[model samples]
Target: MTGLVVPAAARVLSARELRALAEVAERERLGWNANDMSLDEEVLFFLLPYSYEAQPMPLWKCRVIAVSGGLPVEIGEGKRIRFGRLDVSLTTFRRLPVASRKAERQLLHWLAWEAAVASWRSVDEDR
Candidate 1:
């Protein structure tokens, strides 16, 4: 199935920013309908611009390759790999307890920060 990916150069948001994002996600989650595929896709789509300043990465057919250390890592050839967890469907998302959701948000933010650092290093290496 097609998936969204965060761009390599996307600025990893700071802790403060992440908190804000989580708040937004929570709000969205509150009103989300688990059975509505369109709404679910829209929520996922909403995150795209946050990570891409230039041309957005194309959606790709992808699969989760691993879930090491509680992070779901997916791969799609020729497509950017997003650091945050994007695989949680609305159905699954609604089933998660509030604490679990909070934890997930924190983990995602941390992963994004790490990805940003790695991306910066790669750019430096190219110089």
Candidate 2:
């Protein structure tokens, strides 16, 4: 029997996305229980919006692995890629709550705000 293999190009959430996800976890008060079942479940819950036809397992697994290192992984190449994508995506206004669009823009904005704050705090702590 062979196990399913996901390609490297498979869409894993970038670091910024993961940080935004961590913000969702933090907002839900799940940050303190890093390795708990409830925290894992909550993370899955946030990913629900991005799911297709109720099958979010693959994407969820990828994201969970990326974020498992910590709430805010060091800002690096992945973060640069995430920000670049956001820059391109925010150039136009779009409707939301509809099946196709969902609330992706709002979610991204919120995540960006959270990531900024987290970055600032990390910098402050270094001083």
Candidate 3:
């Protein structure tokens, strides 16, 4: 049996956006960035906002898997790409809750932010 194939749109999260995420992470005080982390069931999954105009989405999503040398070596989703190892600044880590409901709320907020940004960009492009 052949599995159904779905065409997924590509998106990217720019360094600036990453910085924002980092700031959030840092505020949460996950650590001084890159402080070894353990892979838990709770992962930060960022959603990419759909846009008609093709602008590289800044880091589709980031997974807080591990921290090395104060750097977050986590998984990231890129536009039409899947990054196995990705890193974020201390700030991003701050926004992420190591283990709590706060983490889930933060994830939702991040997703909403991405969607809003994508929609805005698409509208701007049309103009």
lDDT of each: 0.34, 0.32, 0.36
Residue-wise lDDT of candidate 3 within 1-127, one digit each (tens)?
A: 7643222422233334444555654664422232333222222333222222112222223343221221222366322211232334323333433433453454445456667888999999999
- Give all TM-scores, in the order shown: 0.26, 0.29, 0.27
lDDT of 2 by residue, 20-112 (tens): 555654564432222332333222112322211213111222222212332333556132111211110111102111212333343454467
RMSD of each: 15.5, 14.9, 16.3
For model 2, give the 10-residue run with minimal summed lDDT: 84-93
Compare candidates 1 and 2 on lDDT and give the better one.
1
Error of 2 at 47 (Å): 1.7
Writing each residue's lDDT as its tens digit, candidate 1 over 71-104 gives 3334541212332322233333333333345444
For model 3, what is the C-alpha lDDT against the true structure?
0.36
Give the winner by lDDT: 3
Enumerate residue pairs that collide in model 2. none
CA deviation > 4 Å runs, candidate 1: 1-67, 71-99
Most TM-score-accurate candidate = 2
Residues forming the 10-long window of minimal summed lDDT in candidate 1: 58-67
